[model samples]
Target: MSGISRRKFLTCTLVGAGATALSLKTTDAFASAKLEGYPDSMGVLVDLGRCVGCRSCEAACNREQHLPAPAQSFDDPSVFDQTFHNGQKRRTDEQAYTVVNRYEPTATDQPVYRKSQCNHCNEPACLTSCFVNAYTKTSEGAVIYNPNICVGCRNCMIACPFNMPAYSYSSATNPVIKKCIFCYDTRLKNGLPPACVEICPQQVMTFGHRKELIEIAHERIKARPDRYIDHLYGENEVGGTSWMYLAPAPFEEVGFDTTMNNEPIISNVKDFLGTVPMVLAIWPALFTGFHLLATRKHDIEQHGDDHSAHKEEEKKS
Candidate 1:
């Protein structure tokens, strides 16, 4: 019988296990036990009508995070003219944790400025996708990451539903995932608002408990139905986010992806995640058995060859 060495067996087993995990169907436990997040989690409510496209939040965020200087001054309005291929506006990157985008939807008479950052989902896909446990969801509704334990796999970048995570590709020796942490270390945990929120000249953002923010957002819409859109952008999107939006125009026209379902991104792959532990525990023993069987088969073949030679010697005698 053809035999496989222990090394080859282990390699093939790992590959097979990964493929199997990816193709698995959703399990009942994961489907049934959906996480709604902490009841008292803090959040931010952004009123787009109040935003003046000044980008004060961006400047404050940059200063607070001590990030690299930008290509243009934060006060420069020319940055609003910047657009990528297919007309995609600026997004978060290694240098900038937050960005304000200018969207001129036909429905609105004036330009609608939208601030973009990590939504800090209740059940983040990045947190679930990381095998190293590098991401954490704090009770304060902050989704923070640890660069020390990050393997630099870039899995978080691909797994993020909002495309918020960015890799520090410029660093040659050590690169890690970077994203907005809701100012957990500096301000949010200390019971103070984020730097961006505090610096907004127009008072565009309101910070408080998530549930309270939801009520406030609804109250604003109800009070001025003609001025604001009826829908709250992030209230139920992707299993509810720590940061929500109250836009004057349709969310889709303002660069918001309205088609995203309310279910958490992790729910789609929970079955795969659930089986990882089992694979780690069982595969070593199973492959060790394969190695033992292969070794025994090799010994049996050698013994048969020896017996055949002895019979031939007897015939010659």
Candidate 2:
């Protein structure tokens, strides 16, 4: 088989084994299963009203993450015009954990800038859909990945509604999915704001508890109705995201996915989850009934033979 196919097969096998391991019931069972994420986990609120698109956040991310130098400096405005094969703007990649893109709004006189990165969903699709226990949603609201255990199956990428999680395709042996981890290791652990947020000159991004950020975002919107969009981007989308947005124009005009459903990502997979219990509960009975029915003729024939023998024995008597 080709190398890619071979890797895919191995990934599938590993995923299957991991899933089986996870499915095994724990011996130390508890009465209640706690939900993921800490109650006081912090998040960031990006008010597009304040962002000047200076790319300081991008520069800080590059330095803090030790990513490769960009082809063009962060100060260069040409990056705003850069487009990929599909005419879509370039997003965060392995070299860049965060990126800012410019959007021109018809309703507004000036262009609005938006930053893109991991949204860190409350019910993260990446966490639920992962067959391997390679990803974790921390109490601090950061979705972290262990590259050592990752099989490079890229299911996390497929499952992510935000299209986050870029893979390191260039590496042959040690390739893995790469994305923003909310500066969990260096900054967030120390109770410091993320590198991007700290470096933001415009103070566009405010880091704090997600709950408080929601109220803060709304307060800003309410206070300056003319300066902000009426709705917060992550308030309901995908069961609410750790990273939220406040935009001036309708989110769609500035490249936000307005069509994203308010329901948690897991809700979309409930149909499959619902079928699983039914299959587990009904399979044995359904198969046993079929087996008994299939053997009924043979059982009846044996009974008839026994009856005939009894009649012969009676006749002899």
Predictions: Cα RMSD each: 7.7, 11.8
Residue range 77-180, candidate 1, lDDT tens digits: 89889999898899999999999989999888899999999998999999988999999999999999999999899998998889999989999999999899
Candidate 1, which segments miss by more than 4 Å at Cα?
1-26, 275-317
TM-score of 1: 0.79
lDDT of 2 by residue, 1-317 (tens): 24334544565566556545543432112112323346887999998878888999999999998998998999999999999989999887778888899999897888999999998888789988889888888888999999898989999899998888899887899888899999999988889899999989889999999989989998998899999879999878887889999998989999898889977777676656755765586556555654665565577679889999999999999
Clashes of 2: 0
Candidate lDDT (C-alpha), each: 0.89, 0.84
